[model samples]
Target: GAALRTLTEATTPALARRVAALVQEAVRLRPETAGQVAGCVDRRLEQGPTARPVLLPLVTGLLDGGPEQVRAALATVLAAAGTPASRPLRRELLESLLDRERDPAVLDAVLHAAAAQGDADMDRSGGGDMGRSGAGDPVEAPYRREDEIRGLVHRTGLLLVRTPEGATLLDRGLADLGRHVPGFAARMARWLTEAPDDWAGMVGPGARRTIENLAGVRVPA
Candidate 1:
């Protein structure tokens, strides 16, 4: 009984983490853990979004585990995490899944995850849903600010993008200007460090830059 008690004490934490891990990882094994995984997911959902981030790694792990119902589970988990604030983590999940998952339907969902964030490829997002076409008539010679932000974001990073407004606030140009100006990334980083009480305006620096570079003006020299 002593040995058994020791084992239980030692394993309790590890087993708990494992149970959590297996919920997503079990998808890789496929079929074998199907029922158990479903139960785990149900329990996780019962706990709600508070636990969604913890589920990220497992869903990502199963993306490589081969053809299985895990895709359904992953889709459910991701859809749950699809709030505006979760966009960054969601983008990472999509890219990682793209590199792993071979199933076409699964891949399609991955693409939508990537595409839903317009600034992901360009500075864009209408509530994290892909809206209509680029915000300008392509026929114009001089591109508009939104067009520019879109172009710069595409050039900078394709994983996260955001829409920028006004001529004075160009992110890509600002990044470039900062390169010449120095302490820019540092200062900007510091300003953001203040952590405004409002997260509705909160966006990671990279995503913000994607939008910032896409600002609506010819960047000044």
Candidate 2:
């Protein structure tokens, strides 16, 4: 409570940043403070650009080393702060974390965060096509977004499938991605089917079935 009060009353970006850093340290020392600290940070972010630069590093630091609760909280905060200007940074932050984060709960948060930001970005840009260029040419934004999502899926899928929860989270994330990105699920299914036999065999039956259901494909018995 004191932490949030301090953040709310902060007179400047520097002050807010300092308070946010202290809150991060508090979470480090007392994991139970994570929810409060995360709430404060989320509110700070609502102040917009000024608070974002200050809190971005704080969130990154927490995600890097804080306890599971803190990481998940910050991940959800990022998901909620899905403004167009923050999309690239948010995606990058989640992508970097997914590469090294192994805890299922944390992975769940990160995957959902990524999906939320991706969908928000697409929606703000006017759905899958992301609007057309002035010269009647297709805009490159959606293509870039597609590339970003493709990289995320390809990189995280194999690693996440190693555990049941990770596999399930990955499936759900893909389903979310498919809702906004045209044909993403079908493309992912193709990727899965085309993988080497060894790699395909590594995916458990439950994981495969979940993926198939979302992707609208049925593997033959």
Candidate 3:
């Protein structure tokens, strides 16, 4: 725990990565230390966005090369840190992980972390004057934001469909994202239909059926 705490104090990215490696080694040598390490990391992450810069290198280092348990733990830690103020950083970290992670458990944790961001426009619930027009009418800001999120979901789905394990988690994560962003599932269904060659052959029957059902797409007999 104490060793992991030193990650926050690391002055450079190199140093942070080194500290992260040490923590990983410690956890490996003393498996029981995993819980305590997670606790220490959680406390620092709870500091919110301010702690992101300091933690990013450490977290990235771990996610990049740590053991499965360590990677999963770090992903869960990022998910728990998900808040309106920290969503961007959390999304960035999780999405990056999505690109390279192959372990089913780690991917599951990353997907859950990404889904835990809730709605894309959630941060706008505070009613800021930033997106208003000269006539005090709402502009296309929210719709545009939703569109961006839809695109992100599409890209992420494409990545997830590349492997059977990832495909198994795809529908559930899409459902979670759809709960926050209306029409997301249907939109993704349309995307899949438009490009059948991209994912149709990659995912198994079970995942394809689940995705179709979730999106309300009919599979003709």
Candidate 4:
């Protein structure tokens, strides 16, 4: 509560960023502090449009921390940004996080946030294409969004083949998306199947087997 009050009163970007960083650090050290961090973020976000610059660095910098810390920071931000007022910033942060995050739990959180947003966006559009090209021209259609999601999923799949906890993270994300965004999971599976390079070469141990199991194609021996 004090952190949030201080953040609400923060007058300069420097001060705001510093406070945000401390909040993340606290969450990292003590996950029980996540509620406080979320509260601080929510208060800062309520400060209006100017909060973006302050929050951007705070949210993005969490990825540079240890995996557990990153997961903590992601959970904090995702919970705080669930409001309509924070939707735009949340989307931006989600995209940025998904773009570079390598940790499985963090990636899973990002995908969940994106899928939730997509569900909302789709609902608001009444399930219609958002004024894009016709179905006949897939290339000219609204592809930028799809491309971003695809790249993130592909990168995560690569990690799934590499990291020890990758399968657990992916399985969790798949289960979550299966409920809210079934197509997202399908897209990830498709990307894994059509990966440009061999997943085995990306990292050591469990790589080939994981890829083979998920993608249903054996790596040549």
Q: What lDDT would each prediction earn against the true structure?
A: 0.39, 0.60, 0.60, 0.54
Error of 3 at 197 (Å): 6.3
Model 2 residue 161 lDDT score: 74
Please state every model's RMSD to the true fold in angstroms: 17.0, 5.3, 5.9, 6.8
Over the stretch 82-134, how does candidate 2's per-residue lDDT look in tens digits?
55445455655565666668887776665555445455665556664566756
How many angstroms is residue 115 displaced in model 2 relative to the true structure, after the best TM-score fit?
A: 3.1
Which predicted model would earn the best TM-score? 2
The residue pairs that clash in candidate 4, if any, are none
Clashing pairs in 3: none
Off by more than 4 A, model 2: 1-21, 24-53, 79-81, 95-100, 125-128, 132-140, 158-187, 190-203, 219-221
Worst 10 residues of 1 by lDDT: 159-168
Error of 1 at 55 (Å): 2.9
Per-residue alpha-carbon lDDT of candidate 4 for residues 1-221, written as tens digits (9 for 90 to 100): 56544653453556655655665566667676555554565566665566787777765555455336545456446533254466567667666765666666655555465455445545544667766334443321335655655555455556564575876666555555644563543444454456635433433334334444554554443
Q: Estimated TM-score per prediction?
A: 0.32, 0.61, 0.58, 0.58
lDDT of 3 at 124: 40
Indicate the TM-score of model 1: 0.32
List, residue by residue over 1-221, the lDDT tens digit for candidate 3: 56555654543555777888887787788767665665565666556677776678877777777778777777676554343455567667666676677776665665554444333334444545347656676644555554544454455556666677677677556555545544455655665676666555443555456556767885321
Q: What's the residue-level lDDT of 69 in candidate 2? A: 83
Which portions of model 4 show Cα errors greater than 4 Å?
2-11, 28-30, 35-49, 60-102, 132-142, 179-182, 185-221
